[model samples]
Target: MDKFEQRLDQAARAAWLSYVGGRTQDEIASQLGVSRPGVQRLLALARQEGLVKVRIDHPIATCMMLSQQIGERFGLDFCDVVPVDTGTADSSYQYLAVAGAERLERYIERSAPLTLSLGSGRTVRAMVEALSRLDRPQHRFVSLVGNVARDGSSNRYDGIMVLADKTGGERFLLPAPVVAGSVEEKEAMLGQRLFHAVTDVALKAEAAFIGVGRIDRQAPLFQDHFINEGELDELLAMQAVGELLGWPMTQDGDVIDCSITRRVTSLPLELLRDQQLVALAGGREKAPAILAALRGGWLKGLVTDETAARFILDAES
Candidate 1:
C-alpha cells in the first residue's frame, strides 16, 4: 500500500480499538507503542479522514416503501424496487434485469409446470439472459406477441426463446407478423385453430412477464421497424403514453381504440388482468408509460429500477 493509505489504515485501526473495540486510549497506545496523546491524535485523524468507517445496513425488506406504495395504489400483488445509476438507459435496464431474474426464478421454482407468458424486448431479453441455469422442463413459456413483421423483419428481443435456452423450459411462439396488413388479415390469422390455441394457452398462464414500452418517436418498436412511420404518427395522435402486450394506452392507462390495435397480434389486456402480470422496465424515458400501466391497473406486479420507482412514487404523491 501507498504511504498515506498505510498511515490511514494504522490510524483507523487505532481509532477502532479506542472507540468501537472499547479499548482505552492508554491500552491502545501501549499496544501500539505510542503515547496516550499520540493515540488520541491518531483517532482524531482517522475520524477526520473518514478512515474508521461505521456502516448501518438497512435491509432490503425494511426499505420497501416504494414497493408497498405501488401495491396499495394499484392493488398489485407483487413489486420489486431495484437501485439504479442515473446514467444511460442500458445501465438502468441492467439493474432491472437482475431484479427481474431473481423474482422470476423464485416464482418458477415454486410453481411447477407453470405457464409463463413472455414479451419480447431488450430489457426482457437482458432479464432472461441473467437467469441462473435451471431445468424447468415442466414449465411452458408462451410469447405475448408475434415475432415476425410484414417486412420479413422480426423482434430480435425474442425473450421467450432465450428463456427456453437458458432455463430448459418448453416455449411456444406465434408464426405470424406482429402487425398485419389489415384488420381482415388479423381476424383471419386469429381465426385459425393454431393461433387461437396459442393465444388461449397464453391467456391461461399462471403468471406473465411483459416489457413496458413508451410510445415516443425513439421507441424500440419504431426504431426496430416493428412499427412504421404511419403507425407512430397514429399513436402520437392517440396521446398514447405507453403500451403493454402491444396495446397502446394513454397517461391514465386506458387502451386507445384504433385501426393499429385491430391489426396487432398480441396478448389481450383483459386476459392479463386475471393473471400475475409483471412488467419490467426502467429509465426516465419510460416513466410516463410505466406510470400509466400502474395507474390503469394493467399490471399485477412490477420489477423496476430505483429512479423509475421514485419517479412513479413522486407522480402519485
Candidate 2:
C-alpha cells in the first residue's frame, strides 16, 4: 500500500482500538509501537475521516427522565432519548442512527427466526450503515414501503437488501412505486399476487423501524421527487404535519385522506397500528411531525435526540 494508505490503515486500527476495544491512548501507542502523541493524532485522524462514531452506552439521568416521560405520555412500549452532540451543529440524525442500529442489532442477535420490517429514509439508511455485520440467516428483512419511485427507479434509501446482506438473511422487497399515477394504478399494484405475498411477510414482522417525515417542500417525499409540488401543496393546505410510511398525516396524527394518499402504495397505517412500530427520527425540523405521530398513537416506540424530545414534551405541556 502507499504511504497515505498505510496512514489511513493505522488510523482505522487506532480508532477501532480506542472506540470499540476501549483502549487508552497509551495502550494503543504500545500496541502500535507509536508514541502516545502519535496515537492521539491517529485517533483524531479517524474522527476527521468519519471512521469513528461515538455513542454513550450509559444513560444520563435527564435523558432517562425524558425517555420515561415521553413513553408514559405516548403509551409507548419503548423509548430511547440520546443526548444531543453539542459539538456538532446538527447531530440529531447521527445520534438517532447509532441508537437505532443498537436496537436493530439486539433483534438480529437473537437465535430464533424473526421478521423485521423497515421503511426507507436517510436516517434509516444511516442506521443500516451503522449496524454491525452478524450471521443471522434465520432472520428476514422486509420493506414496509414500495422500493421504487414513480419513474421506476430504485429508491436509494431502501435498506432491506443491505440488512439481509449484513445478517445473511432473506429479504423481501415491495414491487411497486412510492406512489402510482392514480388511485386505480395503486389498487392494481396492491392486488398483484407477488405484492400480496411480500406484504404478507411484512405484516408478520415482529418489529418495524420507520422514519417520520415532515410535510413541506423540503420533505423527503417532495425532495426525492416521489411527489410533485402540487401534491405537497395539497398536503400543506390540509394541515398535514408529517408522514409515516409515505402516508401523510395531520397534526393530530390522523392520516389525511387525499388524492396523493390514495395513490400511495405503502402498507396501510391501520394494519400496522397493533404491531411493534418504532420510529427512528429526530432534529428540530421534524419535531412537529414526530409529535403528530405520537399524538396519533401510531408508534409503539421512539428513538430520538434530546432536542426533539424537549420540543415534544414542551409542546404537550
Candidate 3:
C-alpha cells in the first residue's frame, strides 16, 4: 500500500526465496540478478520494515464438530468446545467459560425479556468472572439454585451479583435452601412469596446456564453440605450421575423423582423444557453427570473441553 510496505514485501519475497526455499543468499542473488550484499540488505529490510504478522487460529472446526455431535446426541440448540492448549483442567474450563460468556452476551442481544438462571460451580465461577467484563444492557438475572448451603462455604451470590451488576440487570435471589430438610419444608418455602417470585423468574427465563454436579464423595455440592447424606444415598441408589438445577438425574439424563429427604429446586423438568439451558462442565469424571444432564433435556447449550467433547461423541456412537 505504501512505499515502505512495498519495499518490505519485495524484501520478504527475496528472503523467502533465499532462506525458506533452501537457496543460499549468493544463489538467490545470482537467480534474481542482485549482488550477495544486496540480498543481505533486502533480508534486513524485510525485518526492519515489518512485513510479517503472526496470529493463532483457534480450532473452530473442532468446536463446531463437537458442538454438532453433542447437539445431535442430546437434541440441544448448540455446543461450544473451547480448545485447551494447556493440559490443566482449570485452564481448559476457563477458556470454555469465557467463550460461553461471550456467546451469552450475543444471545442476549437477539433475545428479549431475557431471564438468566445462573448456577454455582467451578465452571460457573469462571464464567461469571469473564461475563462481568462484557458490556450489556439491563435484563433480569435469576438464581436457579440457592446460592448458599447449611455450612455456608461457597458463595455463588457474589458471582451472580457481579454479573448482574456489570450487565445492569435486576437480581432475583432464591430465598430457600438448595435442598430442603423435608417435603413440608420444601413446599412451605416454595409457597413463600419471595421463593415464588424467584420461581417465576426461572419459568420466564429465556436462557439458563447450569453446571453439572457429580454424584460422588468428592462432589462440591455434597462436600459443601448443600445436600444431606440421605439424599445423596438416594441419588446414588437411583444411579444418578449428575445434577441439574439442584435436581438429581440418572447417568442417561433422566430425572430421578421419588421420595428424597430434601428437595429445593426452582425450575422443574417441564418448566425447563422450552427454555435455553446451557450446561458447562469438563473432566472425564464429569462425563456421567454431563451425559445425565443431556438425557434430562435440560441443556440448550453446552461448553466443554475437547477431551470431554470426544468422549461425549464416542459415548453416543
Candidate 4:
C-alpha cells in the first residue's frame, strides 16, 4: 500500500520465489532484472522487518503434556493448553476466558446437542462473557446446576440465559436447587413434569462446561436456601474440595455422596464419560480446587492461565 511496505512485500515475494520456490538466485535476479546480490539484500530486509515471518506450528508441547497427564489420570478425551500471561490474576483469567470461549466455539461446531452445565464462579462468569462475543447459530445450553441462591444474589438461570442467547439456542433452566433440603423434596420436584423435562434436557447434553467452587466459601449450590446446612456440613466433612455441576468432588476429584447429592437430579460425572467436559479456571487461590477437579477427572478439556497450570502440575507432582 505504502512505498516502503509495498517494496518490502515485493522483496519478500521475490525472495520466497527464489529460495522456497527452488528458483536460483541468479535466475530470480535475471527475471527481476536485478543483480543476484540485490535479490539477497531484499531477502535479508524481508527477514529483518518480519515481512517474511515464518510460522512453525505444532501442537503446544505444554498443552499436550498436561492434556495427556490429565487424560491418563482421569481418562478424558482431549485437553487444550492456553499460554499463561505473566500479569495480574484478572488479566491472566481474561486470556484464559477468551481462549476457552474460542475452544468452545470450535467444539460446538464439531459436536451436537451440547449438554452445557455452567457453574457459578467468577472464572465461569468471565468465560460466559467471552462466549457472548462469539456468533454461533445452533447449540443447546443447559443449566447443570440450580440457579437460585440462598441469599438471592445470583443464580444459574442468569448464566444459562447468557449462554443460550449467545449461541442462538433455547436454554433449559433447572428450576430445582442444586442441592436439596431433603431427598423427598428433590424427588417431589422431579415428579413435577416441568422439572422432569428440564432434567431430561440436561441429562442428554453432549458437552458440558463447569467451574469449581471452594470449600471455605458458602457456595451457591442452590439458588435460594434449597440445599440445607446439614448437607453442606456433610460435604465438608467428606473432605470435599470443590464441586462440578452441583456434585461435591473431593481433593482427588472423587464426587462425595451425601444423601442430598444423590437425590439431586443432575447428571452424574460417570455419565460424562464420552461427553466433552471442559472446566475453565485461573488464580493460585483456586489451585487446590482446579487440581482436584483435574485429578478427580472433572474435565476432559481444560482452559487455564499459566500460573494455575503450573500450580496444577506442581500440586499433582
RMSD of each: 11.6, 3.8, 11.5, 11.2
Better of 3 and 4 by TM-score: 3
Rank candidates by lDDT, best first: 2, 1, 3, 4
Q: Model 1, 229-284: lDDT tens per residue?
A: 98899999989999887888999999999988888878678867789888999778
1 or 3: which has the higher TM-score? 1
Give the runs in model 1 whose Cα sits over 4 Å from its true position.
1-63, 153-157
- Residue 220 error, candidate 1, Å: 2.0
lDDT of 3 by residue, 1-317 (tens): 59967667669888788656878888878877778998888988765443332223565887778877887877777787776555566566767677777666676564355667787677886676665234455678878877756654546555568777767778887776677767887888877888887788778887777788888877766887766687677778888777776777777777777665246555676777888778888777787788777766678888887777877778877
TM-score of each: 0.77, 0.86, 0.75, 0.67
Q: What is the alpha-carbon lDDT for the whole of candidate 4?
A: 0.68
What would the TM-score be for candidate 1 when compared with the true structure? Answer: 0.77
Pairs that clash in candidate 1: none
lDDT of each residue in 82-185, candidate 2, tens digit only: 88876764555877888999998888999999999999888898898788778999999999988887778876547998788888999999999877888899
Candidate 4 residue-wise lDDT, 117-196, digit = tens: 66555666666666633455566777777675544345533767777766677778877656655678777877889787
Clashes of each: 0, 0, 2, 12
Winner of 2 and 4 under TM-score: 2
Of 2 and 3, the candidate ranking higher by TM-score: 2
> 2 or 4: which has the higher lDDT?
2
What value does the lDDT take at residue 89 in candidate 1? 57
Candidate 4, 104: how far from true, in Å?
Answer: 1.0
